[model samples]
Structures are given as C-alpha cells and as structure tokens.
Target chain A: MKITAPISTPAEVEPLVRAGARELYCGVVPPDWIQRFNTSGVNRRVFGNLNGYADLERVVEKAHALDADVFLVLNAQQYGEQHLDALTEIGARFRSIGGNAAIVADISLIASLAANVPDLAIHVSSVATCRNVESARFFAGLGASRIILPRDVTVAEISAITTELPELEIEAFVLNDGCVFEEGTCHTVHLPMNKGGPICIDNYQFEYQSAGGGQPHERALRRLEQNDLDYKRWLWYRFGNGFSVAPNGYPWGPCGTCAMPAMHAAGVHSVKIAGREGASERKIKSVELVAQVLRRIEAGESEEKVREFAVGLRGAPGHCASGYMCYYPEVRSRAVVGEVEAKVEVPA
Target chain B: MTIPQSTPTLPAPPGPIELGFALVDERELAAFARHDRLTRDDYLDQLGDARDCVSLPENAEPTHFFLGSEFCEHLLPSVESIDRAVALCERWGLTFGLVTPIACDGLFEPLRAALARLPAGSEVTINDWGVARLVQREFPDLRPVAGRLLGKMLKDPRLPSATWARMYPNGLRAGPFREILDGLGIGRLELDFPPFGAADMYAGIDFPVGVRAPYGYIAKGRICKLGSLSLDTPEKFSPGHKCRRECLGFSEVGARPGTHELHTSQRGNTMYYRHAAGMATAVAEAVANGWVSRIVLSGA
Candidate 1:
C-alpha cells in the first residue's frame, strides 16, 4: 500500500515525499475565486491553500521531481455555475502543469472533467460518500480512477468494494480529522474560525423535551441524562479531544493503523492522511507513522504484532484500549480476542 | 392593510398544485391530518405532542403520501409496513411514494426488497446516486425523483435566507447534471424550502421541483447520537451500531446563547431547523408560477 499525504506549499512537497508519501494532494484557492466566494472556496478548508496557479505548478513540479504524483483538490460537494467554470479552468491549468489527478466530489464536475480533460485522472473524494460497491462502480463509470472511501465505512465494506472492483484503486483514511457528520450529505457551512467555526463542533446547550404526552419515570430520566453524557463524550473523542497532541508528538485522533493489514489484504491501493489545512509537521509525522506501519507489513509481520507496534507509536494505550480513536473499531475486537487467547495459553 | 402599489404581480401558472405528506410512521399521520389547519408558527413552535389530533381543511388536504426515510437506512420501515402504507394510500385515493436513504452496501439488498414491493409507476425519492443507479438498472417501472438530501445547498440555520440564496442560488443545475438526471429517468427534483426564498433558485430548472415544508435539514451523519445512547463507552458513537430507536421517542433541541437565535433540533442522526414563518411565501409564489410542482408537509 502507498501513503498519500496532504501538501500545501512547494516546500511541503519535498518533506512529505521524503517522509514516505508516494502521492501528494493539496487545494489551490486562487485570489479570484476567494474574492468571489470568500474562504469557502472549492475545497472544504478555509486555510493552507496555495494562492496562485504558479504556486500550484511549483508544487506539482517539485513532487514530480521526487517521483511522486500530485493531485489538486476540487472536491466540494456542489459548485455554482461560476464556481464550476472557474474549477474547470483550474483543472485544465493543472493538467497543463503536469498534475497527475484531480480529487473531486461533484458528479457534474467529475463527468465534465472526464469528458473535457480526459488526461487528468479523477480521484473521487470521500465526500462523495462512496460507501457501497455500486457507488464505486458508478464513479468508475464516470471516469474516476481512484475511490477514497468515507471514514465511517467499515473494514468489511471496504473489503467488499475492493473485492468487487479489483481494477479501481481504493484509498482509505489512516489518521487525523474525523467529522461528526457525513461530509458529503452535510449542507451546513464551515465558516471561518472568526465566524464561529464549523456548525458540527459548535457547543450548543441541549434540552430534551419528551415527545410523549405524560412525564417520564425517574429511571427513564436518568437514562436520558446518561445518554446526554455519552453523546458529549463521543463528540469530544470525535473532535480528537479538542485536537490534543500526545507526549510523543503523535496526534490523538481517529486512527486506522491497526486496519492496515486488513486493508492491504482487501486490495486498498493507498492510505490517505487527512488534514490538508493542518501544519506541515503534523502532516509529515502522519505520513511517517503510516509509512512505518506499511514497512512492517511489507516485511510480513503478523497483524497482531503490527497492531501492537502501531499502538505503541501512537503513545496512548488507554485510548486504543477504549477503541475511541479507531476508525475501524472492529480491529479492537480481534485484538482483544487475541490477547485473551495468549493469556489462556500461558501457564498459571 | 394597505396594499403596495409598486408590487408587480406575476401570472399564476396553469394547472393544479399537488400537496403531499411525508411521514416516518403511522404515529405522524395524526399530526399530518391537521397540517392544513395549523399556521406555520403554530406547527413550528407548538407541535410537541405526537398524538394530538386536529381537523384538516377540505381544500388543503393532501393527495399523496411519501413513506420511509432519506437519512438513516436503519430507520427504513419493513416491507410489510411499506405494503400497508401503500394499501392505506390506495384506500385514501392518494398517490404513494417511497423515500430511500443514502445507503451502504448492507442496505442495498433490503432497499431492493422494499423497492420490489412497490407497485408499478410509483415515485421513488432517491438520496444517493448508487441508489439511483440501482433503481434505474433494476426497477425500470418505478420513477425516480432526486431527493432533497441530494440537493446540496448552503443550509446554515444561523445565516439569513438571503445570504444562503445568494451563496447557492442554483443547486444541482450546472454542468451535465440535468442530462445525468435525465439519463437516470428522474422526473422531478425535491428540495427543502431554504430560509431564503426558493423562487429564484427554482427558476430555469428543466424538471418539476418539489419542496418540503417547515423543517429543513442542516446536517446528518452515519454515527447517530441517539443510537449511541444505549452503547457502552468503548462502542459509543460507532457507525452502523444497533440501536433502540431512541429518536422515535424524543429529539434534542439545541441553542447557542449569545450567538444566534436559530435553534437546531436533532431528530435521529439528522439536524434540522424550522424555517421562518414568511419563508414559505416565496415557495408558494413559485408553486403558483409553475416553478414548484409540489409541496410536501413533514411532521418531525
């Protein structure tokens, strides 16, 4: 499997590529588009985008020199007519600059680019919500060469898609940045941090009003309180414990390193490191983490050993044990069972 | 009231407007029956009791019924329930429609089984492209309508309608999307009444448009907060986990004090906001002018 890392500047290209990223992706928000549409540009990010075509060209050139492919992100769920025209122009310019692919979500844009700019390989973004094999096939028919599976999809679903469509390249998320909502179907805007930030992460005080006519019993009320607590805890984990970093410098967030062996066996061609708008150091560390795990898998290490090594690198055994940081929690079930078996085999 | 002499009147479109009801279960039928009698504010602010019954106005009675869900596959009704809904619709002489959610691989078979239960020529609201492709390839007889979930718009409740309308005036209208919809045999496009007016956005579209009233969805996710309520901490917020359908009992309403007046309600995995009282005027005007073909009333 290959590691596809996010890079914004030409400088980030070399460090990310040297850190073991085989493919690089970034968003370019030109001044014109930003002026016309504000920071809610063609991509989901509000920051860390290359400001001009010249910068993007340099990014592509540098990555290509390092024997790595570069993809420009135009992956908004839907774009207006003006936005579409500008994006199509951007796609043509990227192709002219020798960019390898365009990661996109809108079907119209996908079909348009496939027909107009046939040379540019299209990678369907996870925001397209390709959870099923049929969705994968649909995008493939529309000329997408790669499908980035959404983060919420199970390992079994990923296996099913890879198994059904062996010809299409499949990418799965490995580390950092998990959304509480399905990114594709969510219509709420993520305004700038100055403008109260993403709606999903907004701290709103909740009041549970019963739909039933009569008042609920005390036990039922206690259950509802517990439900509220559980919901808040889940949100906290989903937001990466308010984006805290570990003492070992690894980011604490939704991770899928334990599922790497399963994903590799399932024919996932690449693993994606999310957070393109994040700092370059974090991006490099994420790529390094995935690269290390992939190297062990390549060396034919057992899945259990790889899981242990991945947990060790992440540096939070408690979070791993709780399965709160897992993108695929199913792996934890297997790991727990394995531990139980090993304990049983040991002499008392 | 003094009439504004400067207001330009547009000619009403020829043909009758169709009214429809979108219900999650039989329990919602009671609320929907009194839909026409309740004002927009009354419906938005005071409809807490699900069992409350009120009378419907004769002229405003619905002629169609849309069953099932557009967000959660787990919330999909059984095949028997679908058949019963269709039978009830038949008895009431109302047209029956099916709303399918953005489904995963596991839901494909069950959705197909449900689709098979529908009679020929029934309208099926498709929220996912995969579901659209599946219906087009398999159930050729059923007509597909692009659902509101598929219609991507700027739907922040905190923002004014004018801002959202200006930002996303034309949704799913650019590129070859209309042609693609045609290729899929979609006859109509379904949209929610945005806080902003719908007339400008609904204009110049090729197919007929259907608008859902009052509750406009802001966001949705696969990991349902209500479903997570019953699970332990380790399994909390896990996507596709089994649930007790806690959302059917109550919804969590939220407000950000000292920020915005927009209140959000979390029903199941989806977050929705009630549109302003005057927001429907533009949609009503659009309906009068032939831009909007139908108005669907949903009780959350």
Candidate 2:
C-alpha cells in the first residue's frame, strides 16, 4: 500500500517524500479567507496551512519533481455559498499547477468541483463519513475517485468496501491522531488549541443520577464508576496521551500497522497518516514508521512477525495490549489474544 | 396611553405549524401514544424541576411520527419495530418517517430491509450520504429529508450567544449546497436551533426546513463508551461491539462548574445540551415566515 503523508510547507514535501511517502496532502488558507472567516477555513484545521497559492505551487512542484503526488485539502464538513467561488478558484489553480487531486468533504463542494473542474480528481474526505458500500458508491457516482474510510470503521468493514468496489481507490488511516467522537458526525467547533482546544477532550466533572431522580442503586453506581474511568482512558488515548512520542521517536496515538496485511489483501490502495497540522519531525517519524511496516508487508513477512516488529518499534506493549491505540482493534482480538509474548515485550 | 402602543403584529401563517415526534424505538413510540406527548424523565430529573418535563407545547398533538436514530446504527429499528411504527402512524393518521444513522457496511442489508417496509411516500431522514444513495437507487418513491446530523454547524454550548452569532452570522445559506440537496431528491433539511438564534440561520434557504427541538447534539461516535461499560479493558472501546443498551436506563450529566458553565448530558454514544430560551420564539418566527415547515420534538 502507498503511504500518504501530510505536508504543511514546500520544505516538508522533500523530507516526507524521502521518508517514503508516495503521496502528500496539505491545506492552504489564503489571507482573504482567514480575514473573512477567521478560524473557519476550507479544512478542519484552523492553522498550519501553506502561506498562499505560491507556497502551494512550490509544494506541488517539489513533490512532482521528487516523483510524489500532492493533494490539496478542502475537507471541511460544510461551506457556505460565499466560499464556493474562492474554493473553485483554488481547485482550478491547484490543478493548473499539476496537483494530483483535491480531498473534499462537503457533498455540495464535491458536486460543484466535479461539475466545474472536471479534470481535477476528487478524493472524498473521511469527514464525509462514507461507511458503507452504498455510501462509497454514492460518492463514486458523484465523480469521487477515492474514499478515505473514517477511523472508526473496522478492518472487516474496510475489506468489505474494497472487495466490493475494486475500481475505486480505498484509503484507511494507519498512524497518528484519533478522535473521541466520529470526526465526520461531530459538529462542535474546534477553536484554536490555545483557546481551549476541541470540546471532546475538555475536562468536565460528571455525576451519575437515576433517570427518575434521586440516588442510583449501589450496583448501578459501580458500573457508572467503571464507565467513567473507561471514558477518561479512552479520551486520553484519543488525545495521544498528551501528544507524547515514544522512546523510539514513533508518534503515540491511534495506529493500524498490524492491520496492514489484511488491508492490503483487501485491496486498500493507500494508508493515510493523519495530523496535517503536526510538527515536521512528528510527521517525518510517523511516515517513517508506516513506511517500515509497508516494507515488511511488501516483503511478504508473516503477519505475526510484522505485528511484533511494529509493536516493538512503538515501544509501548502495555498500551498496545489495552487495545486503546488501535485503529482496527479486531486485529488484536484475532491475532494477539492468546499470544502473551506480544503483550509482555517492551523494547528497551 | 397611546404613546406606549406595542409593535404591530404580523398576520399568522395560513395553518398550524406541522408538529412531529421523533422516537428512538418501539418503547418511546408506545409511550408517546399512551401519554399523548414526549417527556424526558432523565432530563427533568437533572434539572430538578427548574424546567418542564414535557418537550412539546401545551396540548400539541403531533401530525407525524419519526422512528430510529441519527447517530448510532446499532439503534436502527428492527423490521418488526418498523412495521409496528408504520402501523401506529397509520392508525393515528400521522405521516410516517424513518431516521437512519451513519451506517457501516454491515448495516446496509438491515437498513435496506427497513426501507423496503415503508410505504411509497414515507419520509426517510438520512444522516448518512450512503443511505441517500440507497434511497435514490432502490426506494425512489420514499422522500429523503436531510437530517440534523448532516446539517453541520458550529454548536458549542459552552460558547456565548454573541460568539455563535459572530462565528456563523448567516447559517447554511449556501446556494450550491442546497442545489446538491435538491439534486439528491431531498425535499426538506432538518436543523437544530443554533446557539445564537434561528432567524439568521434559517434565512435564504429555498427548501423546507425541519427544526428538532429541546436537545441539540454536540458530539457522537460509534464506539459507544456507555454501552461498553461492562466489558474489560481490552474490549472496552471497540466499535460495533454488542452491548446491553445501558443508555436506555439513564444518562450521565456533566458540568464544567466555574469554567464556562457548560452543562451536557451523555445519552448513548452522543453528548447533547438543551437549547436556549430564545429558540421557541425563533421557531415561531421561522414558522411564520414559511421557512420552517415542521417542528420535530425529540426526547434526547
């Protein structure tokens, strides 16, 4: 499977490509858009965009020269009519600069781009929430050449879609970044990180009460406590445990390295490393990790060995054992359930 | 006395605004039929009588019944349940509609089965684009309504009204977006009353709009942390795992206290907050202007 890495600058393009990214994706926010809409750009991210079309042109040129493709991100959930003309203009310019495709989320935007700029390939963003084969077929009908499966979709579901629609390219999230809620269905605004981050990760004091008023029974209280603990742990995992990197320099967050064999066998065309706004080093390390796993899968290594190597490289067997960091948790249930060695080993 | 004349009142719309009831399952449908109104016992308990339990206006009888969920595919009604809902709607002379969640591949067969049971003109409120495609291809006769989940807007309850107004001054008035919906055969778009107000949010939209009231969803996921409470750590956050439906019994209330004074409730895998006091007045104005064609009362 090809590795699709996130890039924020022309400088990032060469490093990510050298680190084994066959395809690169980035977002550009023009000064006018930021001045008008403020934080609400064409993408979910509020910051970390290329300076302007000049930067975009530079990034595209650099990627193309290095034998890699660049895709522009216009993947916000929805856009008003005021944004239509500017967005169309951006797409036309990106295509004119030899950009490979545009990653879009809004169906209206997709339809508009497909009709207005026919030559530019469209890859449906995961924010579109294309979970089922019918949804895939729906987007494909609208001129989408690729679909990025949401992080919540299971490996089995991913395989089902890829197997059914062999003609359409299917991409799955394989490394870095996770969301507490389904990114596509979540409607809360993500203010800048400094101004009180995403609402999903905000700390809140929770209290459990009976539906009919008054205190809950003892048994129910116990369960509620467990639920509370589980919820917090899940949140922490989703937030990448304070966004810390592993001792081996691998990024810590939701991962799907072990599922690569199954995803590849299922005909998934590419694997995406999320976190377009991440630091350059983090992005490089993330791409390097995925490239290493892809190399193993390409060499026809055993699934068990590839998983073991991936986990060891992550240097967190305990987190892996909990299955909290897995993008496809079923891989653990199927392959690592009875294997104690995989759970106990921690790379020094 | 003549100097204090009140503002002139505009003429009322031609007819009573269409009222609809959105239920999660067969039990809620039966309760609504028995009580003749929708009530959130949990929501009331949380507020401790500060607010009323009934979500609807006084003595308002609903003309439509919508069954199913907009966020969780696991909560999709069974074939038997759909049949009973349809029968109930027919018996009550109410329009029948089906609300579908963001479905996975495994849900397609069941979703199709449910869609097949609906009558020719039943409204199918879809949160998933895939379901829209399904209706367009196989069930062309069934009308598709763009459910509130698909209506992406900034809905941070913690933010003040002024912030929301500034953030989204004119909500969802995009021509191209509406045209796409029109092309997809969607007749009406479902919305939540924005934190600021509904007047500006509902402006300039040509299609009919349905506003779901009292509780607006903030965030939702497929993993269902509430449902997985009983499982061990290894299996806790797995998506699409079977569960005992713990969310049906009660909900968890959260408060930010001294921070932003944000209060939220967790029902199933989704978090929601009650709409502001101005929503009712805003809905009245929207309905009067003929922009909002329906008001669907939900217990979530």
Candidate 3:
C-alpha cells in the first residue's frame, strides 16, 4: 500500500518524506472561490491560504526537491469569470513545475486544465463523490489518473469496485478526519423559496423527523431514514467513520489517528492523510507515525498488530469501528462487543 | 396571489434544464481548479457542451466555464477587471453572471453600490436580506433572489414547541428567505444545488458522509448535510463546542452513498440518475412539470 502524508509548511517536508509517505500533499494557496458551492462550509482563514498562488508555487517547489509529490487542492466549484483566468494562470504554473498532478471536481476546471496544461495529471477529488464504479470510470475515462473513494465504504464495497475496475488506481484515507454526510446532495439548498421548515443542528434531523418526531421518532421508526443526522450516525457506526474522537472534542494531536494500514489492507493503491488544515507540527508527526506503521506492515506484522499500532498512535482510548465502510449488522455487533485495548504504546 | 381552493401534494417535475452555473469570486474558481486540477480543455468542454442554461432566454449561459463571483467586502471591484474576464466569455458567447452579495456581511450596502454601476436588467444573483428586502421595498422592478433559507428553521434550539407553532414576526424569520418574499428583491429562492454526480457516488457509500465522521486517508463521501441541514436536533441537547459534532447546517435526509449500489457503467442504472445529468434533469423536470417556473442555480 502507498502511504501519503499531509505537509503544510516548508519545515515539515523532510520528515514526512523520510517517514515513508509515498507522496506529500500540501496547500499554500487558499481554495479559489470559483468552486465555492462545494466547500462553502470550511472557514478559509483557518488554513492561512489567503496568500494565493505565489505561496503555493513556493511550497510545491520545496516539496518536490524532497523527492515527494505535491497534490495541490485547487478544488472549489467555479462560478464566475475571474475564476477562469485565475485557473488558466494556476494551470500554467502547475504545468511549469512538473508537479505530481492537480486534484479537482468541477468538469469545467478539469476541462480547463486539459486545455491549458495537458502535462499535469488530473485526479478526481473525493469531493466529486466517486463511490460507484461508473463515476470512477467516468473520471478515469475523462483522464483522471486516480480516484479517491468516499470515507464510509467498507473494504467489501471497495473490493467489489476493484473487481469491476481493475486497472483504476484507488486512493483511500488512512489517518485524517472525514465527513459522514452524503457528498453532493444539495438540491434543497438550491430551492429559491425558503420552504418554511426547520433545520437540524446535530447531524440527525432526518432521524428526528422519521423517528416519530424526535423521541418517538427514534423509538417508533421501524426502518432507517435518509436525513443528514440519521445517515451521519449510521456512517459513524457502520463504516468506522469515527476515527479519532478527541477526548476534548477538538480533532488535534497524534492521538487523533493514522489510517494507512487499514487502507492498505483494503487494497487501496495510495493511503493518504487529510492535509492543508493540519498544523506543521501535527503534519510532520503524522508523517512519522505513518512511516513507522508502514515499516511494521512491510516487515510482515499481523493485520491485528498493524491495526493496533495505527489505533494506538491515537494516544487515546479508542477502537476502530469501520464506520465509513459497509454496515453489516453482524460485523458491527462484533465490533461493538469486541475487546479493544484503546491505548497501545507506539514503538520507540 | 390567491391560493387554490384545494391544495394537493405536487408531483416532482420532469426533465433536466440547462444551468447558468455561477458563483461569487475568483478565489473560489482558483480553489476549485486546484482541488480538481482540471485542464483548460476540460474547462472549455463544459462551457461548449453546456446547452441547458439556468438563464433568461436573452441572458446567455456562461460558456462551459465554472462561473465565479465579483463580490468584495465594502467595495465594488472595478468592472474593467470583470469586463475583461466577461469579454472572454462574451467572445465565446458563454453566459455567466457577475453575482454579488450572495453570502456576505453588510449585504445590501455592497449590492446597491454594485448594481447601480451595472447595466439595467443585468443578470446577477443576490443573497443579501437587506438587498432582497430593499429590492422589494424600494426597487420592485429589479428581480433579486433570496440567497439564504432564513425562516425555514428555528434559530434558537431553546425555543419551545409552542413558540414554533406561532410564526415569529415576518422580519424575525426573514434571515433565510425574507429578502425574496418581502419583495425586497426578486422574491425568488436560489438553491445552492449540490451537483448530482457526487451525490450518487456518495449515496453508494455505506457510512455517514457527514463532517462528524472519522478522519482517514480514503475519501469516501461528500458533505451533503452541511449547508442544507434541517432543524432535527434533540430537544434542548447541546453537543458542545464541536462544530463537527454539532451545528447541523440544514434539516434534511442527506444522501446515503453507503446503501446505493454503484454501477460501473453509467447506462444501466435506473435507481439513480446520471451523476452529472441528474441536476439538469431535476431542474428541467421542475420547470416543464410546472413545479416551478424558474430557479436560480448557484453552485454552493
């Protein structure tokens, strides 16, 4: 399995590459506004990307010299005129640098890169929601060299995909945070007239409504509902989508998680870490952690030990729930009932 | 407008309509391009192929490019820069809009300032309550759509059920839709419709594709529930400061990719629509079937 790590500053680039990360993905630039619809929820100020493309070019060059590939996330949905020209300029820079590839979702951006910078490879972003074999094929057919699978799929589902699309390279997340809502279901947001209704806050509004109006809704509903909240809980339990529940509620520190092995065992071509949002220290440490785990896996450690080491890196008490994968009731039942150490010491 | 003597549940519309996909800024476009690493050809192809535009017949669709916004805080950026960019689109005959004030602070201050400078009947989507409200209140001739879904959900979770039954003051709930209905603007709702392709892909994933899900290297699903959330939190229960855990963006059943079986081929699936085509189809169906006469398409 290929191990990928996130790097943000110039300082951590070396450690991540030394840590056995196959490719290094970083972002020095803010997400361009063209594709705001897809990622309007994330606060841009948090990542310090306000500097724009010049900063990104600097970061990419430094990362490349370390012999690591940089996948710049220019991934935002495009909507206006200035956005197109910005892309053209950015595309030219990407082509000049010989960077690994550009990851994106909007077809127009993809189309733009194809026209402006043919040398750069296009990788379909997970944000594009390529869960089915067809979506993967569509992107691959459109020249996407790699497709990232959604976080909630089980190994079984991934295996099913491999069976149909054998040659396609699959990238999965090993250690990083992921969302549980269905990516790309935003028609309701599209409605021009505000349908005088209510908005659910804690990710389970659909369940609240279908469960007989809240308490009764949870008790009376015989079958599951598809609201954002229910689907969130379902994914958490079924696919192990809940990786590192920060003891303090914030997703920070090494105790959070490192997921490369699970992704490797599941047969993903590349095991990537969620980047850009991470701090330089956390990013460096994350790379080291994954490298250590990869060495152990390559040394032929048992799958149990590998998983244990990965979870142990969390430095907190927790177990893998496979929430993002398929939710087989029996598997979930076994996992819920299984004994897990929750805290294992990372190898010195 | 008078209501019909009898109100019946309306059937979903049929057929897909063309979208004049537009957005708010250059940074957004650059970000999207970097995220996807789309090629110039890919950009042009979408513009050339985009036949169905969500535009007034005279208003052309932005050429197959991902449309972006010209909005800025407290200031209307010079149209010369925008004109230069739009000139590219006009050369290609692509229809894109220079949207302002969709999701911004001090909404109308910038919009009125910007609108005053644009041509009459220029195509633009506005989301500011003040602008929408003022458009209706002052400039009834100008059509501006409400950008946010304000009153549709409860702002305060602590409010009693009884309080919800009795509608709040018209302006109080106006945070989401007041700009549209108050005739301050176009009195139209602009849906930030999440694209369809990824939803189908997301629906095929087994886990919850929400922000609260665990972090890992694999990208399995999209965050569909963020901006389109419905008020479905438990009674007076607070999940604390974890924005990831709390803060449901909207109240709706977000798509579940976990249960849906993903077909390798786009042709064979009946249970789901073509990932990209579905959005267009939904809009066309809505219009052709008269579920709605028009809709403003804002990507996010």
Worst 10 residues of 2 chain B by lDDT: B1-10
Instruction: Supply candidate 3's per-residue lDDT for B86.
Output: 52
Candidate 2 chain A — worst ten consecutive residues by lDDT sum?
A339-348
lDDT of 2 by residue, A1-348 (tens): 899999898899988999999999999987677676664566777677888889999999899999999999998877766777778888998999999999998877888889899999999998888888988988998899999988888888998899899999999999888987887778777655554578776666667767665557999888788777766776666777667898888898789998998898899999999998899999999999999998999999988888888877876677777677789888974355344423432221
Candidate with better lDDT, 1 vs 2 = 2
Worst 10 residues of 3 chain A by lDDT: A184-193
Ranking by DockQ: 2, 1, 3
**lDDT tens digits by residue: candidate 2, B97-162:** 999998887888898899999999999999888888888889999999989888887667766446
Docking class of 1: medium
Per-prediction TM-score: 0.91, 0.91, 0.47
User: Which runs in model 2 stand beyond 4 Å of their true positions?
Assistant: A35-40, A192-195, A333-348, B1-12, B33-60, B160-171, B259-263
Clashes counted in candidate 2 amount to 1
- Per-candidate Cα lDDT values, in order, are 0.77, 0.78, 0.41
User: Model 2 Cα displacement at A288 (Å)?
Assistant: 0.9
Give the TM-score between model 3's chain B and the true chain B. Answer: 0.39
Tens digits of lDDT, candidate 1, A1-348: 899999878889998999899999999878687587754557766577887888998998888898999999988777776677777888998999999999998888898899889999999999888888888888998999999998898899899999999999999998989898999878766665665578887766767766653444678778878876666655666676567777776777888999999999999999999988888888888888889999999999998888889888965566677666789987774453233212111011
Question: Could you give the candidate ranking by lDDT, starting with the highest?
Answer: 2, 1, 3
Candidate 2 or 3, higher lDDT? 2
Which pairs in model 2 have colliding backbones?
Answer: A135-B130
